[model samples]
Target: MDSFPLGVAPHSAVTIRFVEALPDPSPVIAEIIGGGRSPGRADRYCAGPWGLTVVVGLAADATPAQAAKAGALAAAALIGEAIEEAVCAIALSTEASVAFARAFRARLFRPLSLKRAPRAEDLCRLGALTLVAAKPKDAARAWAPWQAIAEGTEWARSLCAEPGNRLNPTTFARILGGLGDLGVEVEVLDAAAMAREGLNLHLAVGRGSATPPCVVVLRWRGGENDAAPSLLVGKGITFDAGGICLKRAAHMEDMRGDMAGAAAVAGAIRALALLKSPVNVTAVLALAENMPGSRAQRPGDVWLGHAGKTVEVIDTDAEGRLVLADALSWGCATQKPRQVAALSTLTYAIMAALGSHYAGLFATDDNLASALLSSGEASGDRLWRMPFTPADDPALKSEIADLRNCPPVGPPDAMNAAGFLRVFVPEDIPFAHLDIAAMTLKAEADDTLPAGPTGFGVACLVLWLMAKG
Candidate 1:
């Protein structure tokens, strides 16, 4: 986690002067504001009293997202200049000022960099953040939740940023073990434990890899001991080589981020612990590496899941739901939580439907769906609700098994995958499935984060859990 030295700066610190609603520059910004017509935009200038200064502007109707972007642009300009400490001179609302402060975290977007040299223009590469606001205390108050959310988001992104070689199943579980230090009771179930518990579907996926798979359960008991907890399940496929059904060599490297869903769950748990929120959460992460090794499970193989349901493997590439099925079943049956939500980098079908901007959401409960939708809006990790297919759906039928992992031929793979998972959970519990296929990696930076891993579900999950309280 990257640390921002809040409210600490030297007298000669660099200045990021934000001129909100600027028509003609006043004496405050005249020396620094270059020729830029629009407000809520970054201007072109450096070399002020402190050495390097970047001036920005904001409009009356500007959003916090806009504020962050503007601040990011300013921060990007100061990246390689070696300007150590800086004060944010912004005359905006408390929300906007806090958003402005978002530009300075060391690990916002560039999650993990094995790159031997420094990056060119990552905004999070900035040094210090001291917000000069109308009411410093008010700004601090507004920044608190966002800071926690940002920390969670950065944690998830860093996990996603790791390459497959560096983040195999064992290493991944080891990395998450550190969360136990944060008061989140973390338990890892290796292959033997999972196999004993009838997690066959999950074990099958990792049979190909030398680094055996595991299931990590994190419990954060912030609420009463007797309180019914909310459950989160993540499909942690550290690397998806598509098993025997191999993917094309082109862009196959991007599959290293397939475990983003698990990363998000861990990140959310970390955030809740940081806030010390009065809510209980049990997160079940199904960790595996799907490789096409000699011992890999072949197509047409059937596995008896944790819930005693048999699923025929139609396509090796559709392995996410297989792991998730046992995870959802084990988590729901063990914890017996109030509500349940599962996330995965599931299918290309959902991505084709919602694009990279929004995850495909499938839910059984209206309230859960509504809360998630609202959280997506508030947290900027958007979701579009999609219908979950039924168990009796003709495409899911199999000759020898209870169901097929995926349809032999399909356009609605996402819907079928969600339905397969829903069969494992008890009917009374509210359930939601987030198919976050294409949102994790990006070719370029967006309003909130830089390119690479966007930390798909953390911020939204944290805010949703907070609202649950």
Candidate 2:
């Protein structure tokens, strides 16, 4: 793992000036500001002496969260690209100023780099940033939580961005083992162990790839010894070639990000552990690779899942849920958690429905759904609730099996996928499914997030767990 240079530093690095509202600027600052009208939010300028100056406009009607997000956006725009040091100069009430500074620092952080070659000059070598605040102590205190969340987000992004060849099931499990250093109890169940436990559904998905299948469980027991931990399951298909039902060539490269859900789960656990939050959390990652070799599971096949339910594979493209079935069942049955949440890039149908702005959230428990929704709103990993009515169940029914992997024909494909997963979890346990196919990757650059992996669920999940405590 590459080291991340994050935190407050002494006053020797480059300066990043952040203004809540622009005042009469000096001649040099004016030249950098240009003649363009200020949009009054997340405006950027390059003053020679200031290095990178960011002006964050806090509208009278804007909430503190919005103002903080704007500050983060402005700071994020300057991350990477060889800036040695930065100073955030913000003038607001001590409370608001501290919040803005913490958010800014979080955004300015960059994740682990995959670049192989050494550059002539350091690229993206930002060493440190100093926060100039009236209340330095308060700002320092606020920085801790945001720093943990940012590190988790960056970890997820780096994992998702890694190529399939480098991050196969074994390697991914190995990488996750490092979390044990942070006091997270780690367990890796290999293919032989899964077979012994009758995880045929998960094994079938990885039959085509030499990487094999595994379940990586991370346990963080920061709360009471006997507390029923909250469970998080992730679909970790490292690369999805759609198995026998192959995908088109146009965007096939993007399939490398199929394991984003697992990455998010891993990231969330890391954040909670780093913060030492007073809550017990467990993450079960179902790791696999879906390819189109002769041994791969094909359409029209039937497989018994970990829950002892039979599923008919109608389309090999819908493989994520098959692996998830095993992980969710195994986690819920063995651990017997109080609540469970699973994340997956399960369906393009979700992307078609919600686009890139929101992930589709389906939960059996209303309170769990509401808590996640509130967390999403607060963390900027927004989710839109999708109905999980009995009406959607008919699409999952099959003549020969308990459920069909994909609907024969339906407009609510996303809901149908959720409906299929709903069968695996017992009704007594509170469960929520997040179809994050849209949130895994981005097509356009935003103020805070760049054009690639967004690491969407890490912050939201961590915040929700923190709220539970």
Scored by TM-score, the top model is 1
Positional deviation of residue 315's Cα in model 2 after best superposition, in angstroms: 0.8
Pairs that collide in candidate 2 are: 14-85, 16-87, 81-124
Off by over 4 Å in 1: 1-28, 33-43, 59-62, 103-109, 119-125
Best by lDDT: 1
Q: What is the lDDT, from 0 to 100, of the residue 34 in candidate 1?
A: 41
C-alpha local distance difference test of each model: 0.79, 0.79
lDDT tens readout by residue for model 1, 1-469 = 2242211111112223333322233433565444434334544554555555566666534577777777677665555556566555555677777777765452233565453453654323344565556666777777787777777777788788777877878888888888888899989999999989999999999989988999999999999999999999998999999999998998889998999899999989989988898999999999999999998999999999999889899888889989999999999999989999998898878877788879999999999999999999887789999998776887788999998888888465788888888888999999999999878887676555556787778988999999984
Angstrom error at residue 373, model 1: 0.9
Q: What TM-score against the true fold does each predicted structure earn? A: 0.90, 0.87
lDDT of candidate model 1 versus the reference: 0.79
